[model samples]
Each structure stands twice: as C-alpha cells, then as structure tokens.
Target: MTTTETPGADTVRPRWGAERIGNAIFAAVVFGLGVFALVGAFAIRVPAGQAIGPQVFPFAVAVILLGSGAALVISALRGQVAPREEGEDIDPDAKTDWWTILKLVALLVAVLLLLELLGWWMVAALLFGGVAWTLGAKRPWVAFLVGLVIGIGTQLLFGEGLGLFLPRGAAFDWWYGPGPLFG
Candidate 1:
C-alpha cells in the first residue's frame, strides 16, 4: 500500500506520549511515598532538649521526595524525554533465573519467621550464610561461621552501644540469664 493511503494515516495524535506516561507514573509513586514518609515523620514524638529531633531526617527525606516528584511531573508535561541508558556489562537478552529468585525469597521468609524464635543473632547469621549459599558460595560452612561472628558483633553493637533492643530467644535467656550477652 502507498504511504499516503495507509490505514488510519490521518488519526489524531495521542494526548500524552509514552515518555510522559512513564514520568507521570514515576512521579505519582514518588509523591505517594513522600506523603507516606511525611505522615510517618509527623507521627514520631520529638524528645525533649534535642536540637535535632528523630523526625528531622525523615522530614528531610520527605521534602526531597516531594520536590523530585514535582520536578519529574513538570519535566514530563514539558515533553522532556530521558535519554536511553547504555552500559557495557548489561546483557539485554539475559533471562531471569526464577529458581534462584524463589530460593532467595524463601530464605528471607524463613529468616523473618524464625527471628522471634531463634533471635536476631542466630537469624542474622542464617540470613547471611543462606544468602551467600544462594549466591553460589563454595564454602558455606565458612560463610556461616563468618556470618555468626558478624551477627553477634552487630547484636553487641546495636543492643549495648546504641541501646537498641534486638530479639534474644528463650534458649539464649536460659543460657545467659534473663538478658542476652549485650542486653
């Protein structure tokens, strides 16, 4: 068929372009997140005598999100399209490994479910080791041991140094009094 006589050749252009639609979606998500963060930040109770309160960081993050979202929406309406990305290491045709993804998801769920029962120290170790194994670590035992040390160290750091409480299982309490090692 001739170009001039092609089907729907004189149709009206779409109201919004693909780039605008994508940018609008991105802006909506970002703006929604900003609103959520703002609400959460406002819910935090500011402690007395503190120059910078706990809400400061969250508020700042919310503001940044709001600003960026607005900028994106404005840019989209102005017909500013983003340039396509080009990278050396990216394999455009590579397919995702569903099995590996499912394994990682299962590990995460297991860790979450076991956290209260096994405690942060044990669960964190398992999480690290499990992740390493899922990612094809040759020596899982060594990874587990290293993860165990890191877990214990992190427990001590957060629980003792930062005064943040992490779960300590009943077994741990029975072995080391009512409180865990650093509790």
Candidate 2:
C-alpha cells in the first residue's frame, strides 16, 4: 500500500510520538511492580491486632500503580494523547542523559557502600563531590567543599537537632569504638 493509503490513514495523529513508546514501557514496569508488591503482601501476617498492618500500604500502592499503568497503556495504544499546538516552544535538549544519570546513580551506590566504612561526614562528602564530578562538574574544590558541608551539616542536623542516629564509620570503630551509632 502507498504511504497515503496506509492502514491507519484515517486515525488522528499522536501529538507526542515518543510518549507512545515511553508510556507503554512505563506502564509495563509499573504494572509489574504493582503485581510484585501485591504478591509480597501475602507473605506477611496481619497478626489480628490493629486496624492495618505493614502489608496494607504496599497493597494499596500496588493497586493504584496497577490501575494507572493500565490507563496509561490503553491511552498510549489508542493514540489518545492530546497533541501539542503549533509553534510551541519546546526544549529540544530535554531528553534524558542516560550516561550522566547512570554515573550519578553509580556514585550514589558507592556512597551507600562507603557510609558503613567511612562514616556519615566522610561518605556524605564523597557522595556529594563524587556525584557532582561524575555529572561533569568542572570545579573539584567547589564540589569537595559542597560535599563536606552537606555531609557535616546533615550529620549535625540529624544527629543533634532531630536526635536521629548516624553511623560513625568503620574507621571510627577502629579508632574509637563499635556501637550502633558508630557501626
């Protein structure tokens, strides 16, 4: 068949071309997560006590995700998304920078691992500077300063102001002692 006489020639054109594929993928993931969460709830026992249990929140969130995922998938398949009007000022470079984002995520995971061995201040500092540097921050000193400040500041805020505990790191354990706060 010619391009002009294609099978879907009479249908309305989708306003957002990329959104169709994106929404379908998003829907599948959300639906899968919802199903998993709902299934996980079965492993927990209610214990016949309070109005709700730990499984309640997960179950509810799962249901909502499932419903929304279904709707998004259906809308995407039907091409029912509204089109952007003509001459709209859309940013051409608004797409996801996967490599940068992945680097940042890797930095975050490293920070989490380092937190147990390096302490709150040290890990926080590293996390801050590392993430920034990984994401192409040019100023190393600035990133370091920012990381240090954030790490120490958050440590003080959570440990002192909020009275929440923080790990003192493995170094602290070897130097001072081992405890829940220090461990």
Candidate 3:
C-alpha cells in the first residue's frame, strides 16, 4: 500500500507489484499469439474433398489461447495475483542472473540461425543439449546423446511415419541421397 512521490510533483503514485505487471504482460502476449494463430489458421489452404482440414486444430488452439488469455487478464485486473514460489532449493534473496538468461537466449538464437543450415535433427539436438546444460545438467554428454536420439527419432517419426515434412539441410544432403529426406 506504499506510495512513492514523483520528482517535481506533489502527487504520489502507488508502485505496481511485479506479479501484476508480469500477469498483464503474459496476458497481452498470450492474447496476441492467439490472434496470430487465428489469422494463420484462416490463411491456411484447405485441400478439396477434405472434410476436416489442417486449420481445425489451429483454430481450436487459438480459441483456447484466447479464452485462457482473457481469463488471466481478468483475474490479474481483479488483483488475484499469482502466488510466490516456496521451493526448498530456491533462495528468495538471490539476485536475477542476467548472464544465464543471456546464454539461453544466445543458444536459442543459434538454433534458429542454424535450423535451415544444419536441419532440425542436428539443430534440435544442439538446442536440447544447450538448454539442458544451461539449466545445470549433471552429465552434459549424456544429455547431448539423449537429445540427439530424440531429434533423430522425431525426424523419423514426422518425416517417414507421419509423412510430414521437416527441414533437412543441404550440408547433410550427401547422406540423404539424391532426393530430400524430409520436406
């Protein structure tokens, strides 16, 4: 309930709580993403003679996102802020680690940049391992191997089993033969 006086102003402004600000931002992002999803869903081309098109799932997801976002915004506006963590391993007094956050961001950026060049299988493995390491994985090599398996497995599942296209970069084209292994 404490208020801070503005410089060169007699009027005082109540400080906005972090929870409220975070909730508002989260709501806005979710709502924006929902709208984007809806737009994208509508833009998808429906093949002739298909009763249920690919847009159906995206539309459903968009509706859910919109509803959840609206609910979150309303709850936040009503001052029903999220509860703080009470974890045993957490230190409440510890300051935010900007460096770790930066590392994670950099890793994600690397993955994005390399996705088309190195393909989903290679880049996804790197991404998964990088994230695991950044989050303090005990055995990074094991994590990397597991991530590699997951990446390759997913590629096979989507590309071969499901007949879905996934990026297979030019660098590994030799291994993939004359035709593209994935879409």
Candidate 4:
C-alpha cells in the first residue's frame, strides 16, 4: 500500500487536524458520561410525600453535564476547539511525572481496599496522609494528624449532624453489633 502525502494540505485545512478529531472524541465521551449520570439520577429513590429529595442535586448536575457536553460536541464538530493553556508557571517541555501519578493511583486503590475494613475516617486519614507525604510534606506525622482530624470531623459532620452515616468498620460491626463507632 502506498500513502500519498499532499503538500500544503495541513496549512490549507487546519480544521480537519488531529486535534479536532481528539476534541470531538473527548466531547462524545463527556456526552456519554452525562447520559450515564442522567440514568443513575433517575434511578435514585425519592422518599414518599417529600417534594425534594437527594435526586434533585444529581438531576441538576446531570443536566449541567448534558448541556456542557452538547455545547462542546457542537463546538468541536465546527472546528472551534478550545485554546491550549500556557500558564507562566507551567513548563511546556516538561515530561509527565508518571511516578507521582503511579503513587497517587496506588494510594487511591489502597483507600478503596481499606474503606470497609478500616472504615471511612481511617481510610480518609490514610489517603490524605499518603497524598501529603507523596507530595513532599516535610513532617509526615503532622500531615497524618491533620488528616485524622479532618477524617474524624467529616465523619461526625455527616454521620452525626446530617444523619448520613458512613460504615463504622465492617469487621468491627460484625463483631460488636452494628452500632456506630462514634455516636
């Protein structure tokens, strides 16, 4: 097979470039995600005799995503792609920090794995501390302490104040009767 290269074609037809195709594909993915969110939003159960429920926020977010996705899709199809961001602090030629990304991903996986066993607060603290330490925190112990405080505070705020209880510790729950650990 022989591929012919048309000289000056790229300069003449900038609209049909690789960036345009990538933008369109990204927009399509966003639109698909919006559709998924909309379906999930509709699946949420509303309490009987209540006007507004938890579904309201999801529905609103779904609508926003859908609209934005649609707009992006149209813009991309018309070759009106967004301009590349070039911040003063950013190095254009800098290589991606894959090591940092890998560490973050590993930490997230650990959080997911330990969420039920260690409980939300403990896992949250671990995640925060891990991220802080990964990002060059001088005092990792202090970071862990702060993460613990934040984790416990969120647990209290959501579980006690808002009545949205997180799992207390699945293993502990099985052993110590399903009562909440903190209230």
Q: What Cα-based lDDT does every candidate model obtain? A: 0.82, 0.76, 0.84, 0.83
lDDT of 4 at 143: 85
lDDT winner: 3
Quick one: ranking by lDDT, best first? 3, 4, 1, 2
Ranking by TM-score: 3, 4, 1, 2
Per-residue lDDT of candidate 1, residues 12-95 (tens digit): 444587656887789888988899999999999987899997798899999999998888878777656675556998775677
Candidate 4 local distance difference test against the native? 0.83
Best TM-score goes to which candidate?
Answer: 3
* Residue-by-residue lDDT tens digits, candidate 2, 31-50: 88888888887777776876
What is the TM-score (0 to 1) of candidate 4? 0.73
Q: What's model 2's overall lDDT?
A: 0.76
- Per-residue lDDT of candidate 4, residues 112-138 (tens digit): 888878887888889899999999999
TM-score of 3: 0.83
Pairs in clash, predicted candidate 4 = none
Q: What is the Cα-based lDDT of residue 58 in candidate 4? A: 83
